[model samples]
Target: MSVRATTVLTHVTASAPILLFIEENGACNTTYNQPPLLILERYEEEEHLNLVPLNRTKHPLCNYVLTNRWPIDQNWLYVDDEGLHTKSIDREDVSIAFMPVSQIQVELNLHCGSDLRMKRSLSTNGEQNWLGPYDYGANKWILTDSISYNARRTLVNLIVKDINDNSPIFVGLENEPIVVGYPESDIEGFVSPRFLVKVEATDADIGENAAIMYWSTDPRVVVSPNTGDVHVHNTATIEDNYRFTVNATDRRGSGNTGSIDVLVKLLSSEEIVVITVQNSFLDDEDQVLSALNAAVDYDIKMLCASVVTGNIEPTYKRQQSDDLGVSLRLFVYGIKSQEAIKVDRLTSDLSDSNIVTVNIASVLSLQDHLDKLQICPLPGRDTGLLVATIVLAGVVLIITLTVAVCFFLKRKKEHHYDQFSDRNSLASRNDSIKSSKSEILPKINLDELRKSEKKLQERLDAANGSSIAANDMLPVIIEEPSKMTDVAQTPKETLINISAPDPKAPIVIQSIDKLKDSGADSDDDDEFGEKNKVRRKSVVTFNENVEKIIHLEDGLDEESSEPDIEVYKF
Candidate 1:
């Protein structure tokens, strides 16, 4: 089933327009030479015309404009001047890509079916071909991907909607332009002409259709392009009719303009300067007065005073009065300036007009204050805090390094001590063990002890065989002191080699105690063989356990025991 369709590439001068309808079965049916319905239509695009599908019957989903309303519903989506919009929609499963209206034809894709469905056939990417031919009579259609689709096909419908819907509106206007300034009243110290009047407008359209630009037709008046802000000439006089029209135009151009008639008059222009006096301390009223006098001399337009307690930084001390014109700031700070005064000059803020700082310390007298108006002393510049901070940081660093070094040295010493102690204990234990091993042996020499015992036994035997001599016997005779006899005086001990007595021989024994008692003190002691040849002899007898004992071989009886007995030698 072939159908006839009109293309934008060429125009046919036909009496009636034709339309092609695709049926549910794979059939394309055409209706030609349709009776024309009268409708007024206009197209600014002269080169081509794009015919859309179902352009008339599609109704807006809402009663009035709901874009500006708050607390919208959740389920359904709405379309406004900003294109399609949804209140709260999930973007995870279905993603939305925004493109301009001109790119609609290029982005059009037919998925499972050529028709638009809320569920299936929503969108396909750029890789797939959008739509092609189907069978002539088949009830269902299929794609190359073997996806079965309902053959009821609807084309990609281009919505012929959201044309130029609104015009610009003007905001906040007086009956006529107010007399903002006077030409003759242009005094140097007044507050009237230092003001700004604002003129503005708004548009509710979206995108390029909503951007409103502004301009003025008159030479005396000027309008800001972006904000529609109106600025008049400062030198405007009252004789001039400041009447002019301010026009606001949307980006669509042509008939989208909104305008308002404004009549402005310049009563006069006066250069008024405001002088703000900021001071504290109730006792400094005299200083404040002196400052005010200085302002009067400089033609200060506005004078004020602000009281504060604590100190303020120099940078933030200069208040920004961009709306106010040229003014002087006299900061009568009650702080003393002996040690802390250090600044010379600071940046002046002239965002709107030039502003200068006048110090209370510099304004001692009227003449001094006058000289300072043209040449104010610069703000005090102090760097003591920064320098002190740097010094403190350096000291901390030194202390930290010293502590670290000390800790390292202490650890090293402790490690060395542990090693030394271990070595010393091991050495001492080793020496003790070695000494114990050496001492586990006999104390005496075996050979020397055996020889000493043999010598002692031999001596015992030799002393048993020896005998005493006969001369070893002593006779029992006493010598008197009166007799000068030459005899051995000391009692003598004679060692005589004597044999053992025969077992039959009797021994003669005498008590030496009786002989010692009977002293022979005879006067006739020298009468025996003359004095020099005296036969006086002290006799010693035999006894047991004595050194030598005399023995009579046969002359003496075997049982003789007497006191003061004598024995003779052979």
Candidate 2:
């Protein structure tokens, strides 16, 4: 069953507007001129305006009209300004109905006996649409609508939100410029002007932003970008200000700039000159003299003494001299030409004698001491006699020692030989004395012994049948008394051949004179006659002694028989 109910809806309108409400089917209606209690800005788009409803009562489950106007329809009118009035044409003849703003819409929709359906429809009157959510009789509704907004304001919101959220945003400042010469921040009088100068500026912004252009506030200073070379007037005075400006510009024509001030002043025109003296003892030249001209001395006389010793080569000395000469010449030239300060006197006095001794002594002390080592006198330079004397002294000492030892040994040997000779001489002399006394002594009575030996020999010969010579027997009776007395008185020693007392005595016997002249009369001697003569001498001596002994014996025998008997054993 379909029913159409008509109510004269009135609206106060200065402009077309869309309305919002619920449909009789109980779904929210976004249709134009239907269930419209809420109004919004118009939608002129070709599509139907989508309207929304606000729950005026602030209810959670339902939406109701906020106003109490009796003639309210599902979605009808709204008033922006308050003076608008509306009267509805009531159809009293039909079934008259009034809603309690909330229950009326619900009852009407429930009386329709069907679930609600919603649509977005346009009004036949051609009013512009307002976009909002519509909840005619639903339990809930979300109002949605769109109004033309500012895109710029939306972007600004996003930016503001990022800032409030502490999001990252990058920003950079322009780079500072670097200027030539003295910086403005520099202390005064620190740097002088008329010096070569340069200036530069940099910007963090890219492209042409980083380019630094230089400028000069003072015309005296020139700034060049192509070369980055700054040149100032050479004659600039101390009071002169050479200000250079450097500008850093970005592609956006934004940049920073800096400036430098350069002051020019004259240098003191006084140069300090210090002189230090050095002496080398290990060099050959003694007392090196360095001479400087009058130009180097305000008082005009400068004499320095430099000495060198030991490694003492000519070259080392020459090198030192050359250095001294150069220094002196340079000093003189500098003073005379006004290029440097002149020396009126040394600033400080120094004596290098101690230093020279210390250094050179340190080097040479390790060698043998000059006094200790025997230095050969340069040959040909010393007298030759001294050298010869020394050599001779050495030789004499050696010879003297040799002679002393030899003499000592020789004397000892001589002493030993003397002792032996003395002993031998005493022994030999004793033997000779004993031998000579024995030989010279008469061993027996020579006369008597000779006579007895001859008688014995004759008796033995006669017994043995050997003939005795008559001449030998005649010698016994006819002997000369004088000859016999001569023989008897002569003391003679007998010598036996077997037992001779003298070692030098002759063994073969003969008369002394005959033996001495034997060689001279050797031819005249007759062997038999010589033998007879020898026998006669023996026989004569033997008979004489016998006669004497017989006489004596007879006398002795007669005397012995009596008391006064005298006898001798012959």
Candidate 3:
């Protein structure tokens, strides 16, 4: 029960020597050149011949031969004995035929009168010959060496010998040394691709004298050196079965072919579908939002998802939410809580009137999407508080200023009144002096005062004629001598006294100084009294030089027939 049968040689030529071979047994024998043995035995005395002549030239020894005899002819004759009592005799009808030999051992041992070896004997007379067999200890067969044989070498030296001569020969592989390299991958097909493949072959018997030949199941594959590099002329196929064979040869025309079965199952180009909602009315149109949707769909489709940042949005924050969504779908196949999508609002608050505006940005990522997107409005109280504060400040400032101005004006008025009252009051000596002087000051000029006494009397009469009782028109008088003396010290008083009183009117003094200056005498007064009906009397008397005026009760009697000057002090 061998798994495989050995190569068999079914046809043998009759013109050549035919050999019977048993490969594993290592034994063989050659066919004889002539038919060797056959003889007949009678079964019932009717004698049957088992021999037949086979005239086929291709097998000239197909017939069996029993005796070395030809066809015989005979007639009846008497037997004769030599010279005594026997007569001469002849027997004629004879035949040459063969019958099958029953025992091979007996036939080989049978003695025959005709010697077939003697027909071609070298010696003239028949003689027995002896030969000696080789007497070595024993014949033995051994293998001294082995080699790698290709089909051609095995066919010539090993295969042909095994078939034609029953020789003990077989093909063997020597395990030749070889160098193999994987191809470089980057180059396209066979043109110095990044993936490189190469092989160098060598045989033990030939050293570097080994050549390589290659064949591929795929025509698109190209092998460099036609024998070594397993290069892909075209891109490797993904779904096909391919085989590559490398035939390593020796200088002796021996070759060994090894094959490799390759399943070139190249993956098909990926089907990538990027979905974008170009029309965006709100944040929903953002790339992140769109990408999120894609994640859901892609997850359902069992496709990988990824977010690709592009010019539309470069950074993570600037990236459109929709694009982020898509990228998440691609990378994670869906948006997970851990990989949250960051949402950024691209908005402008035109209504906000602050000179500086706030920029709102948010990161929507696995960790912070929901947390970052929460928006809170500014408190309303702040605006009102600012305006109210400004109004209150303005009002307070105005009131304070008003109060200051009023206080300043009132203070100024009080000061002015105090100064005026201090200068104008009657209790003040300064004010009293001014009043007294104003009352006593006469309207008369000094040059007019120097007129003739008659002219003065006429001017007095003229002045007295228009006044009441003429006493009111008189000069003011002073009761105190000191006050009277004080007025006399002024030059203006000398001018007022020069005008004499009129004889018909009484004199009244408006100033104490005028009274003191009046010289009242009895004889002059009697003369002036007869002419004048009224007289001005001084309230106090004064010595002629002392001028210490004292009031006189009746000593200066009204009927003393003297003119008196009446004096009064304000």
lDDT of 2: 0.29
Per-residue alpha-carbon lDDT of candidate 2 for residues 213-303, written as tens digits (9 for 90 to 100): 5555565556664434566545643232333343322332234443444332222212112222233321322222122221123211111
Could you tell me every candidate's TM-score relative to the true structure? 0.24, 0.17, 0.16
Give the RMSD in angstroms, all C-alphas superposed, for model 1.
31.0
**lDDT per residue (tens digit) for residues 1-570 in model 3:** 112223246453323232333344233223332223222222221222212222345333232212111111111111111100111111111121111111111101111125434433532232222212322223111111222221111100000010111111111223222212221233123222222234444332212223444454556566554445556666553232233444433332334444433322221111112222221222332344444444232211112223333223222132333432222221111212212111111111111212121111221231232233234323576678889999999999999999999999999999889877866565697668878998896565555444533553443454534332334343333322222224234322211232444533334332223343322231233554552222334322221122222232222333564334433332
Off by over 4 Å in 2: 1-311, 314-421, 426-429, 432-458, 461-570
Ranking of predictions according to TM-score: 1, 2, 3
User: Model 1, range 1-570, lDDT digits (tens) per residue?
Assistant: 333435354664334333545447445333121111212122222211223121222222211121111111222234322333233222211111121221111111112222325323333321233443222222111111222323222222121123345577777443333222222334323323322344677764445666788887777666678866666556743343346788888874553988777643332221212223333343544554454444332211111233443333233345443322222233221111111111120111111222243332112221333455448543442366667889999999999999999999999998889877855688887998889988885376657666744653354355544443334443222222222222334333322322444443433232221122122333234546542222234444332323333432222222543323234443
Q: Sorted on lDDT, highest at the top, how do the candidates line up? A: 1, 3, 2
What's the residue-level lDDT of 543 in candidate 3?
16
Identify the leading candidate in terms of lDDT. 1
Predictions in order: lDDT: 0.37, 0.29, 0.30
Alpha carbon deviation, residue 164, candidate 3 (Å): 99
Output the better candidate (1/2) by lDDT. Answer: 1
